[model samples]
Target: MPDTAASKRFTVPIGPQHPALKEPGHFEFTVDGEIVTNAYVRLGYAHRGIEKAAESRNWVQNLYLLERVCGICSHIHGFAYSLAVERLANIEAPPRAQAIRVIVAELERIHSHLLWMGVSAHEAGFDTLFMYSWRDRETIMDVLEGLTGNRVNYSANVLGGVKFDVTPTQADIIRKGLTFLEERTKHYLDVIMHDTMFLQRTRGIGVMTRSQAEVMGALGPTARASNVQRDLRVEAPYAAYKDFPVQMVLDTRGDLEARFEVRINELFESYRLINQILDNLPEGELNVRVPRRIPAGEMIVRLEAPRGEVFYFIKSNGTDKLERLKVRTPTICNMTSVVRLSVGHQLADVPMILAGIDPCFSCNDRTVQIRQADGGAQPNGLSSLMSWEELRQYAIRKYEAR
Candidate 1:
C-alpha cells in the first residue's frame, strides 16, 4: 500500500545537454522539498549501430571498427574481438605479442581511469583535481603513442595477433612514464582525499548500498565501490591476464567518494602491472599467419575494461564476413544503479551522481533490431530508443509476433 503520510514530489529533468556530463543523456528526478525521492535515466543519445556495422565488414576490417566503440576502451574491444577470432580460427599469438597486449591494456586502463577521475572532479566543481588528473593522463597517452602509432584509437590488434611491437627502447620509455604516473597519482590521491572541500562535496553523496548495487547489476569501479569483488581479469582471466595475476579492489561505502577512491587506486595498480610486464618481457614471433578459411563456430570472450567487465560474442559461418557480433558493455550494467544513486540528492548533485559510474554513453546507447510484423520500420536514432518502457514494449511485440 502507498504511504499516505509521505509528501508529494515534483519532477525535475537533467540534461540531454548539461555542463556536468560530456555525453548526451537525460535524467528525471522526483523531488520532495530539497531532497530527491526517486530518479529515472534516459540514454541512447549516441547509438551508431556499431555491431550491425561490424557484420558488413570482414573480420580483419572489424578489428579497426570495434576499436571505435569507445575511445577510452579502444584496446579492450580490439583485444576481446581479436581473442574471439583467434579462438575461432585456432590461432595463438606469440608470447611476446601476449605480453605486449598486456602492456597496452594496462596503459589504456591508466589513461581511462585518470580521464574519469578528472571528469568526476570537474563534475564536483573541483577544477584543480580535474586539471592535475588530466595532465597526468597525458603521460600514459604519450607512452602509448610511443609504442603504438596512434594515441587515441591505437589500431594495434590484427586478426591473428597484434600489429604494433614494442622494442627495447620503447619499453624503457614506457617504464619511465609508468614511474612518473605512479608518483603523480600518489600526489593526486592526497589532494582528492585529504582536501576537505573535495571530500565534503563527494563523500556520502550518491550512495548505493551493496544489495542495491547487486540488484542493479553495477559493474567495474561502480560495483567495486559497493565492496563487490567482481573483476573479470581476476575471475575469468583472458589473454595476458591469464599469465599475470591481478588483485581485485573493493570498498563497501558505495558513495561518490568511494568510486573515486577505487579508480584512483586502480591507476596505481595499472602502473605496477605495466612495470611487471615490461621487466619480464617475453621474446617470440609477434604474429602467426591464420588460414583463409576459418572454421564455422561461435565464441564468447570477456575482458576487464577500465570501467568493468566487457563481453563480446562472435559467430562465423566459415566466411570472412561474420554471421553475428554481440557486445555487452559495462555502462549498460551500471546504468541501472545510476537511477537508484540519484535519489535523495539535490539537483546540483545530479551530475556528480551520474559521474559516479564514470559512464560511457556511446557504449550504452547501442540498439539492434530484427524485422517486426507490426507494419512499421524499426527506429534508428539514439533518442528514439531512450525510453525503457518503449524498448520493453518493442521487445514484447517482437517476441509475440514470433
Candidate 2:
C-alpha cells in the first residue's frame, strides 16, 4: 500500500511541451497521490493579435488574416468573416457560391474532426487508432486540394464568393472521395465506440454534469456531450446552412466517451451534408460584385465551425479599414470547463481528458488581456478576460449599432 501519511500534494505540469497535445497549451495539475485534486491552464502562448491587426487592414486583406487563425478551420473562418462583411455591405453571393461554401465547410469539418480523433486516440494510448484516423484524413485532404489548390489552407474563399470553381470532373472526384470517407469513417466509428480499451479509458472519465457544462459555457461537442442542444448551424443559419438543415447532436452522459461519440457521429453527418450540397448544387454565377465602400454599420455573424460556434463582430465606419474586429473562438468558450473536468481524475488520464474537448491552443493563444485578482493586469491564455455576460453585451451592441 502507498504511504499516504508521508506523501504530500505535488504540482505536475502537463504541457506547453507535452507529446499528447497536437499544439502547445500549458496544463498544471495538483495531485494528491494519483488522483488530481485541481487543475489550472495557461493560454496565449500563440496569440497573433489577428483581431487587432484586422482593424488596420482593408476589409479584403482581413479575409486572409482571419483564415490563418487556425489552419484546420481556415475555410470556416474565412467563410464567417466574409459573411459578416457581406451582411454589412448588403451583398449576397450567388446560390452556386453558397452551395459550394457549404460543401467546403463540411469537408473542412471532416478534416478537422478526423485530425482531432487521431490526436485524441494518441492521448488515450491507442496508437493504432491514431494512425488509422490520420491516414484516412489524408483522403479528405486530397479531396480539398483537388477542389482548391492547397491542402491545408485552401484560400478558396473571397469576400463576395469563392476564388476557385469546381468543374464537373472535379465534382465527380469529390463525390468519389466522399464515398470513400463515408465507408472509412464507419470503421473508425466502430473502433472508437466498440473497442473495449477505448471505452474503458474514456467512458465515465472526465464526466461533467449538464448544469456544470451550461454554467461553464461549454460549446460544440463538449456542450453536446452534456445534452445541450445548441448548435450555431441550426440556431443561426449562415451561408449554405440557411439552405441545408442541420440536425444538432446531443448526449446526456457528459463524459469523455460521450464527446468521442458525438464527434465520431458528426463525421457521418458531415458526409451527409456534403453529399446533399453536391447533389443539389445550383447553377449560377459564383460571385457577386462587392462595392468598395461598405455602408457605415456593425454586424455580428456566427458560424458552426468544426469546433463549435464561432462569432465574428465587425464594425465599419464607411471606410476600407474596419473600425473594430473581434472573434470569439470555440476553444475560448470550452476552456472554462477544464478545471471542473480535471478534478477527481487520475493524473495519468489528464491528457486524454484535455484532448477530449478538442481544444485549439493556437486559436486560444490570441486572446485579450484583462485585470487579474491582484491589482496588476495579467493575460489569460486562449480566452479573453471578458465574461460570457460581457460577450453577450458586446454582441448586442454590435447588432444594434447602425
Top-TM-score candidate index: 2
Q: How accurate is candidate 1 locally (lDDT)?
A: 0.83
Cα TM-score of candidate 1: 0.87
Q: Where is model 2 more than 4 Å wrong at Cα?
A: 1-7, 367-402
Report the C-alpha lDDT of model 2 over 225-336, residue by residue, as the tens digit: 8998879888877778888897888899999889988998888888888878877888989998887778899899888888888888888999888999888999988887
Model 2, position 304, has a per-residue lDDT of 85
In order, the Cα lDDT scores of the candidates are 0.83, 0.84
| Position 260, candidate 1: lDDT | 83
- Residues 276-323 of candidate 1 have per-residue lDDT tens digits of 888788888888987766689999998889889899999999987899
Residue 231 CA displacement from its true place in model 1, Å: 0.4
Worst 10 residues of 1 by lDDT: 377-386
Clashing pairs in 1: none
List ranges where model 1 is wrong by over 4 Å: 1-9, 367-402
